[model samples]
Target: MQPALFAELRRLYAAADVAGDAVQLPLLDATATARALLIEFPQASDWPSVGATLSYLADELALPRPALSVSAGGAFTLWLAFASPRPLPQLAAFFDGLRVACLSDLPADRLRCHPLSGLATVPVVPAFDAVVERWSAFIDPGMGSMFISEPGLEFPPNSERQAEMLAALRAIDDRQFARVMAQLPTPPQAAMDALPLAGHFTDPAAFLLAVMNDAAVPIGERINAASALLVAGRR
Candidate 1:
């Protein structure tokens, strides 16, 4: 096993917040001269499509075709082992093109890449099982589930506050509800408008629920909405 490659993969797994034992090492090809790159996604629906697209991309770019595998976790592992050493530029270009191809088909936030082995001059036995054992041991179950919650992001609607706001809104008539909504700040107004519910929700609580759950909405707007809800509830 290449120590440097293992270290890099370890770092990437942590940075990407990959779920429990989600990392997969690149498998050695028939000649055992090269190891493949690993790519993972959050969902399984697109894995086969991505694999096909990658194969097409490799042919179009005149790059080495990668051996593709799928994991239960919905990751697509692409292997492109070379029997002989290749130029760094050649490898870099291939990976770059692969990245672009993936981005064109999937959301950028859902993709991750991990380099398992460096360019090799000679065939080396890929330590796939060993790598898996090491990673399985390295993962901490206590760490909890992985998600995209960034630091400093303030999400709206903690259970207690949301309940209070909902209760308050429920007590109001439509005229009063409209008045309270009108008093909401511009940022929350914009956020609410961006939601699919927007003006369509008959209940204020449901509208807030939609705003709270949308990951695409700005955090500030969500917070603003929560605050507005609290203030409106008081009225």
Candidate 2:
């Protein structure tokens, strides 16, 4: 993190409750502050969408803001908003939606497999490497494109980011990885590598179906859903 960005993060944390406008002047030099906010920031009372979060930041900083686009399908989408003009509100909204998504209230049989289509309605935001790893467990490797699309960003979402996420899961138990991957679209090869045989699932398909059917699963499950996708196909 840049010094100016780190200072801005400290300021944001200290003034978390302060309106955006209150701290805008002091944070102008801190471009990395937005990235840090996505990393360690706590979940807010409401999960504002990436666009909404950006709007909030723009309102706070008094900068020109852009419209946020979200997909209706995958967990990866929630982390895509940061590339937009507003990264904060999108992440906030994403967290809120994830809570709702974890409830598994939607009809699994009726749900289509659109990768990020499910998250299309949710918001996106910038996240730190850790947070990305945390969210990747829910993405289906097959479903998630090797690249992410962001408005105004010429470069696609970093492949290294996804690799880092896979590394994080690899550190956990296979059962834990299976449990997490169950809720996602389809697992990728990289994510599938995170699971240990004999981990929570007897078969990857079982894990995926289990998570899709269990709407009552918690946010942790939703976060893990990203990984389940990979396991399912491998089974």
Sequence-dependent TM-score of model 1: 0.31
Q: Scored by CA lDDT, what does every candidate get?
A: 0.37, 0.30
User: Model 2 over residues 201-221: C-alpha lDDT tens digits?
Assistant: 877567765654453333234
- Work out the TM-score per prediction: 0.31, 0.23
Q: Which regions of candidate 2 are displaced past 4 Å?
A: 1-80, 84-204, 213-216
Q: lDDT by residue for model 1 over 1-235, one digit each (tens)?
A: 3344344333322222222233344332323222234454545455445556555544543443433333323234443443333333333334444444444456545554433222222111121233223111111112112211211112221334322322221112235323423442333354335654345788877777676455454333444455456568879
Question: For this target, which candidate reaches the highest TM-score against the unseen true structure?
Answer: 1
TM-score of 2: 0.23
lDDT of 1: 0.37
